[model samples]
Target: MALEYDLVIIGATAAARVAAIEAVNLQARVALILPHPANGQVHPQSDFYPYALAQIAKTIQTNRGQIQSPSSYPWKYAYTAIDRLEQESSPALLAAMGVDTIFGTGEFCRRPHLAFNINQRYLRARAYLIATGSVSDYPIIPGIQSAGYLTLDRLPSLVEREIPLRWAIIGAESIGVELAQTLAKLGCQVKLIVETEQILPYEDLDFANLIQAQLEADGVRVYLATIVTKVSQENRSKLVVMGDESIDVDEIFIALPDRPFIEPFNLAGVGIDHTDKGISIDNKLRTSHPQIYACGNVCGNVLGGYHSQSLTQYEAKIVVHNALNWRKIKVDYSSYDRLPWAVYTDPPLARVGMTIGAATNSPRRDLIILQKYLKTCPQAILNNITSGFCQIVVTRTGQILGAEIVGQNAPELIQILALAIQQKLKITDLTTFPCLSPSYTEFIYQAAQEWHTYNRNQKQQRQNGWLNCLCWWK
Candidate 1:
């Protein structure tokens, strides 16, 4: 039988799943095509799965003198979540929502026809959403290929074996930081290398300083402004040579950046525009070909930033609405700027809108900047974690530009700033809003007061200069 769907979504990541659900809700027949073996944290080649399994095995072994088999862990967790959901809701919930799941790789057979190799059978679909996410990308470093290092997708499994006591991680992005911390917690001597002058270069300098301090205190050796020239194996240990420096480690885990996994599917034939970054898409999430849409890692919108799964789902919602209701509505992503995000390291750093540097360098150079120290906040004193502060940027007319927090629960605290920015709320609006006493959020009120005071001083200075000019003219 020829299978046809009003909307077809490729990949099963957060964005793809949300697109499928939203399309179905719009009364469109939806077909979701996933990889033969899902490749993500939730399913197949995820690095975190093995660590989670090992934790479960340890728990079971402690309770019952025998350890649970490692291979059964993924299935065990999958069934547990599915069973719990089914028991709490209806078994046919997914199907009833009009989303049909097809397990296979989806490739373009024609302009509007998508061929899916599902369990060794062929299937086709209509409109398609390319949300294939991404895979780890390895750069062409000298001798590194022959050294056999593991990508972020494969590192979790290697960590589960727990064989490598001495480990070297190349790259200090979010994944590198997480792996370095996780392996250190599991008793591995971790050494992290980054080509940049500082770790988390995309983040604010203050946040990076806090994270670097924490990692060093944890006994993790971080080499910054260094590049890995080559990697080779010697005596069953990985020898990584960075410039003139050589380090021997049991395993070399590459937390290096990833590019979109688009080559295998041969997307060029389908007329999709792509670069080293990934597929190109406009604000509306529409690719060069109007009928085809892209989201998530496959698109370069968020790049290396920690875009929450929730935000990707939101982007997918925009894609679905554009695909289904193109006549009645047009998707706009300008308002999507300044989304809040964070690094999950201890003493987490969260930011929204623009940074002081970003604002100064931006075309909006007329912005007013105000910062309040965490030491001034009551909660920071009580918690003994006065390492960071709250910074807010506003315009002369009191319009909020951006906010950043770099202390405990900074991610949670940044939520209010995100909401304020989204609503285009003025700084004055926050002064009257009731806030809890003795909390980190009180810093917002303090920062607002500082901004007002600075604004008044600037106005008085301007008035005095004008009066002096009038006296000279008289």
Candidate 2:
């Protein structure tokens, strides 16, 4: 029997949760499908674990520096907290909302009418949203299949049960660097293995190098510009190889974002467009098929080109509105640049909007770049926490395009930048805005004020060059 509903949201990601809740609010019957029995969002293995590990590392660093504890790593307490976070969602909550939560794989059917086959039951909805999120991507290293390794999603389970010791993370992207630094700070010997010369490659080149240096300073050995060709187990230890050189470790961690989880739907049979990257979506998040929509990291419209829970939550709202309402309101993702993202390191890395790469390809040709290092800031010196800088990109007209920070309270500072960019606030406005003296925020004001000095310097340099060229010609 085919159960009818107003909406059917595939997967149990945060995006799906939002659509389910909104459908319940509209008094529409909604079916929410899960890949497994466990809610992926609350699972101990997902995004929650790396975050838990980072906080534990911070606590360890704080206590050791303060002389409160001699041991730098403590997994016992952190695991306890992680276990608490894994508590499954109450069934009563879903029941109260009237959401039919089915734990099974769903395949869309093309025969007769548009419907999904979940287990043996058929569900036909007025509209469908594909919010299945992403699946993990591992490197193409030989002997990796037989050699057991841990992905970020499965990392919490490893930490919860095993003793903290030797760990070699195979990828220094956001998650890799974050977990590598975390494990190192928590008394584990960590080697961050990446093929790129710099960590956080998506960030500004300078910012990426700065964070890589910070990782090294925190006792993480970063092996850059070389891929792990092979991984094998030797004498109870995992050996990772890069050409002639090799290192042995207890575990290998995959700390990269996931590929879009859309292949199972067999979208091509129904004429929905997608590639290995993800499903293609317009500015309004509509799929090629008029009846289907895709959201979250499963779509090309992902603002940062990374998997983001906050982004999933935001896009979920837009998806639900357009899916159910008679008058489909176009999605306005203009403030997508304002979405603040932070990597949880000792001195965190956070950024928003265009990177140096983005500005180069942008329509705004006359761009101004302003940067200020925290080492020169009074607050950083007083606090003895000065491993950071603030960089901002803007147009000639002073419209803030992007900002990046690497420093204490960087995650918080980026928020101000996010709000400023969202409101289209100008550099002069930030510089004139009164802020507490001897604060990290002064970095923003200082960076903004540097633009005026940069203009004067540029003019002087041009004049001096012109004079020198005239002399040479004579």
Candidate 3:
């Protein structure tokens, strides 16, 4: 006999689990299908490993200056800590929460009716969500496969082993850049190769430049606008050839873009629309089939470039509400623009909405570009960490359009602006909001003060012009 469900979430991704949990909370029967499971259970992977390592390495760099060896910090303990944090999303935990956690691969069928077939059982649901997540996309380079390289997914295995003395990171993605800085701070020589003119192609140039400078300051050799022509093994070292110039390193890491995992689901036979990037979805996040929906990395460009876990979880909530309720709630990221996302770098980089360039070209003619440096903040000055700033784009009347932040607790600080933009709050509101003393958030207050001062000056100039006209009439 075939089983039925309110929703069948395909894949064992974090997004999949979120959708299942959310559906259950809405009083819906949910079946979560895990594509590949060991012993009928799936263990979730931790995305916090790189962030944890980066923080630990930054602390070491601050206290001990240049590390002479990678063993200066306890790398194994960091991995163990991350492992300990994984039980919260375990299959057993989900099952305990009333989710039907099925373990195996599945394919969509369309013969009699749309159904998912796995392990000789058929799953028919009112709606289906594909959240298989993404995998690394390798660039075409000669001898790369034969040379053997590590992707971000395989990087955690090296924590148990000795850190390589030297590394050649092939791409400049956020994860790749984070690991480069971490490895460099841990006393490894890192060579970062970028194919574009800048490191992060999607971010503002100033933001990307700040991170690149920090990477170089941490002793990472950056090669901008460069590509790896080929890769070969030379004795015990790997040779990364870039045109006539070549460098030999102990190991090579590939950090290309990620493509969605959708081939196994047999979407073509089921008449679902998809591409090399990911499945196509409307504003409601519905697939070609109205009964089907997708989210997370599987949705590809749905969230633009902010593909963080938090945003995916947000998408999961939208999918759940729309799947269970009669009235569908559209997936609107923060009301006006994209939600904020951060890169776990030394000083960190957090961004949301329009860049300065985008804001300048906006329909709003009266735009206020408020900027303040962290060097001016007491907390940053006291801590001797003052190499970042906050820049916000707003209308003359105080409507915030976008913001870019790079400084201490930047990721945390940017959220304030994100909420402000979402609620359509004015710049004056930020100026009046009470902040704890000696906090990084004071930078935001200072930037908001600029708008206040500008507004006062404009009012004064208009009053003066009116008085001059009165004198002329008299």
Candidate 4:
């Protein structure tokens, strides 16, 4: 006999599991399919490896004057941590949570009413969700595949062997940037090549430059606005060619854009609109077939930002509600303004909402830019770690439009701003918000304070001192 479910999630990713749990909590029968063993089923917390490695690298960097050699602590501990985390989300645990877990590759069948056929079992559901994640999209450079290279997923293999002495990373996405700095800090020679003019093309130019300078200071050779024409094996080393110039390195790492893993599901059988990017969906996270939906990396450009686990979790909630309930709830990433993202570099770079460049190019001309440097913060001075700044964009009337933070605890700091943006809070709210003395959060308060001065100046410029006093008194 075949099984039936209210929701059939067609992937084993973290987002799939999240939706399954939510569906079960909402009193719906849920089944989660573990697609092909090799599909990109990454644990949501896999990002912990890079973040932990960055911390180890920072410690080594701080004591470089006395330390003769950095230890292998990062590799030794980071991989083990990820292994332990993966066990917690194993299929068995998911099954225990009332998610009828099925392990096998599957495809949609239109016959005898819509169902997913897996190992001769017909799993029928009222609605289906495609949460299959994405895999690294290697560029089509000549001879590169033959020469061989590593992607972000393959970096864990480095633990089994020695770190490459010389490395050429072919992209400047967040992973590439984070690893370049971590590797250089560990005493490896790294060359980062970016086809775009800036390291992080989507971020503000000045913020990108700040991270670039930090990478260079850490001994990374940065190549901007350059394209790799070819890659070839030269004796024991690999040569990456860019027009007339070439770089010789012991290994190459490709960090290009990701291609969604949507092939196996046979999306066409059910008429789900999709492209090379991923499945297309309405704001409510519904596919062309009202009975089906898509979320996470599988949604591709339909969503913004890198593959953020937080954003994926948010999408999962909306998917569960819309799939199980008739009263549909639409997803609004708030134009990606309410969703915060971060790159875990040494000091870290975090942003939410519009950047300075984005705001300037936007049609809104009433926006004001305010900046506060870390050097001026007493906490930063006390900790002897002053290296970055916080910049905020707001309206002339003090409403916060967005924020860019590059400094200690940036990821944690951005969340506060993200919440503020989500609530439509003004700069005055942030400035007046109580904060601990001598803390990194003071950076936000200081930046928000500039709005007060700017407002005062505007008021004075419009009228005499006596008029300004009268206005204030009223």
Candidate 5:
């Protein structure tokens, strides 16, 4: 008798774990196949360490020139504290949930009627979900491979070494920006070479500009609109050559987006196609092959953010319900349509839902923009940290469409905006929400109130046509 399952999930990351748990609840026999973490199944703390370093950087900046309990090498904490893939995708937990967990990578077999081969064990299923996630992609510069580099997976080993005195970052994406600021705060001479004209091309220009300004103020040399043509090792230093500039540094970091993990499957052999971004999946999370579904980073451009774990968790819920049940449920990310993300810089950059750029370019011509500078906010003034602002995109009638926020506590404030957007609350509705006398949340209510007052006055002025307009007199 051949071993069979109702559903077989590939990869042992967030989506796989969630799918396994849900499958068991639905009384479906599910098996999760994963490579040993020591091999390649591990989802490294690449995304997480930047955040930890950011917190440490904030502490260092806050206590600078002041007496405080000092940890000489604060950057080491980025390595020491992280949750591993094994702990996250625990075999014992899966066993408790009655999910058979296999240790090894699996591939789609073409011969003998199409089965999946997990090392030597064969697995046949009624349906399948690929959730292998993505891996770090190193930059392609001349001599990059020979010169060597440090990725997130190697951060732990860096803790054992002496703190680097100088560092050079090749990209100014979210990771590059965070790492540059963190390293600079930790006393490293950091030079950031960028490939984009803007620090964060994917984000709203206002938020990206603020973060770039902060990075420069913190003593980071940011080189914009340049590319690294060559990288070489010379006399115990890494040599990075960009247009008209050559930087010699003790360490070089390449912060790029991760590529999907799709090698083992030999996808083309199975008529499954993919781009450099990731595996191609429809809005329903279904692949070209009818019975196969994909979620998480493996689904590619469908989820576009540095840390899309939240989206992955949501996608997993939909995948399990559809992959096993008779009626397929579509994966919908537009419920909130707000991707509230944080950059984890000292004063983090956070935004939820549609951004200013998105709203401005949207076909909706009646959208009104509302702004509140952090300097004017009571909490920002009281806290003595007033270097950012909050922006909201609203319809003429006050329908809340998007929000962008920057500075301390922006992450938390964005959460409120996320909920408001989810509920389809308007700017007028926000104005009615009670806020504490001296709190950060007051920024939202006050901004809405100010806009409402200004809009009302404009309406009244328009109604009093002859008195307000020179055209009437002419």
Candidate 6:
């Protein structure tokens, strides 16, 4: 018997779930296939969700907040507030729009379509969404396999494990930083090793330095400009070799970066071109085969370590729209120009838009960069939290080029800047906008005011230069 559907999404990730719901709204039959479990990328085991939700419930109870019943906070809520809404409402929502779910792995049966391999059976669909997402790539250091290390996918499972007193984590990527902090808070001594001179090499140096300070303050031993040559088990503990330095660790985590997860799908048969990054998709999210659409981490356009779940959802919406319309719609990736991302570690580093290095190197050398230390902020002083700084880059016209923040709630604060950048709001506009005083958000306005001052100084310099040139000519 042949199974069929109007649309078949080949992953049960955030993108896949969004695509499925959108297809259903278009009155298309949909089947979502997953090789393993359907839990979202971050919490595969579904354990973190319950723990997070419980914490939130406890916080609400302590505050005597009466928004919703405590029962409303479920394991899914632990993952995301949106996930809770989706779980409680998406099924009925999709069913009302005519979408169904199928659990399995999908393979390319032909071009522009796929055959799902589920429970030893093959199901087919007219159009397919290759939103399988990306997988983390662990380093192949000698004895690494024997010593045993956990990937991002395995971290949730380790939540139940008794984290030993001494832990060494290599790589200072978001996962590494987050895990290091989580473990440290749970009473584990964590030492983070990174090849880069600073943690979060992709972020602005000022922001990175702030995070480094925060990590150190948290009792995490951060080893900058370090390389891991080998991993070995000794004395019932993991021994990590970094040049001449050797460290004994009860648990060693290798937080090496990730690559695209397209190897198993065999895209060669479908005429989709892919590199180590991901499948080659055009701005329209169309693969080599026009009918086949791809999005999320499967598409190479996304910077692997720097993207957030919000950005992935935004991309998924574009892919779904173009797929349903069949009319070529160019995806505007300008959002990433000032894309906001946050490191979940304590004193989180959050940023949107270009860094100082990028701005200085770009063709637009006329741009100006301004920074404000958190120590100077009234709120930070009041809270006794002055570990980070805020930075803003703007053009001569006062248009905000980028913004970066590293401090408490930096992640939450970056969203406003991201919105401003997306809408092409001027720096002056931020200062005039109504915002609550004595809040971290006020930093945005303060930063913009600093930019204005810098802008005036630059203008004065340029005017003086012109007068000097004229005087010389006379």
On TM-score, the candidate that comes out on top is: 4
Model 3, range 228-301, lDDT digits (tens) per residue? 89898899888999988999998888878777878778899977899898999888888898888999888785
Candidate 4 Cα errors over 4 Å, as ranges: 37-43, 61-72, 302-305, 333-335, 460-474
TM-score of structure candidate 2: 0.85
Clashes of each: 0, 2, 0, 0, 1, 1
lDDT sort, best first: 4, 3, 5, 2, 6, 1
- Go through the candidates in order and give each one's C-alpha lDDT: 0.70, 0.76, 0.82, 0.84, 0.77, 0.70
Expressed as tens digits, the lDDT of each residue in 93-169 for candidate 2 is 66677998887776888788888888898889888899888767755789887888877556545544555368888
lDDT, residue 232, candidate 5? 91
Using TM-score as the measure, name the better of candidate 3 and candidate 6.
3
lDDT of 5 by residue, 259-341 (tens): 77787786777677688778888878888887788888877743335656678888898988888777878766675366577
lDDT tens digits by residue: candidate 6, 136-198: 675778988889877666644443444356788888666787767655544457799999988
What TM-score should be assigned to candidate 3?
A: 0.91
**Decoy 1 TM-score against native:** 0.81
Give the RMSD in angstroms, all C-alphas superposed, for model 2.
Answer: 4.5
Q: Look at candidate 2 and give me any clashing residue pairs.
A: 45-153, 73-186
Worst 10 residues of 5 by lDDT: 62-71
lDDT of 1 by residue, 286-387 (tens): 788767788877775562365355567777888888777645244455555557877666666777777766876778657887887777787878888667
Off by over 4 Å in 1: 36-96, 111-126, 158-160, 303-311, 328-331, 362-365, 455-474
Q: Which numbered prediction scores highest in lDDT against the true structure? A: 4
Q: After superposition, how far is residue 4 of candidate 3 from its true place, in Å?
A: 2.2
Go through the candidates in order and give the C-alpha RMSD of each one to the true structure: 6.0, 4.5, 3.3, 3.8, 3.3, 6.3
In candidate 5, stretches whose alpha carbon ends up further than 4 angstroms from where it belongs are 36-41, 61-76, 84-89, 302-307, 333-336, 361-363, 463-465, 469-474
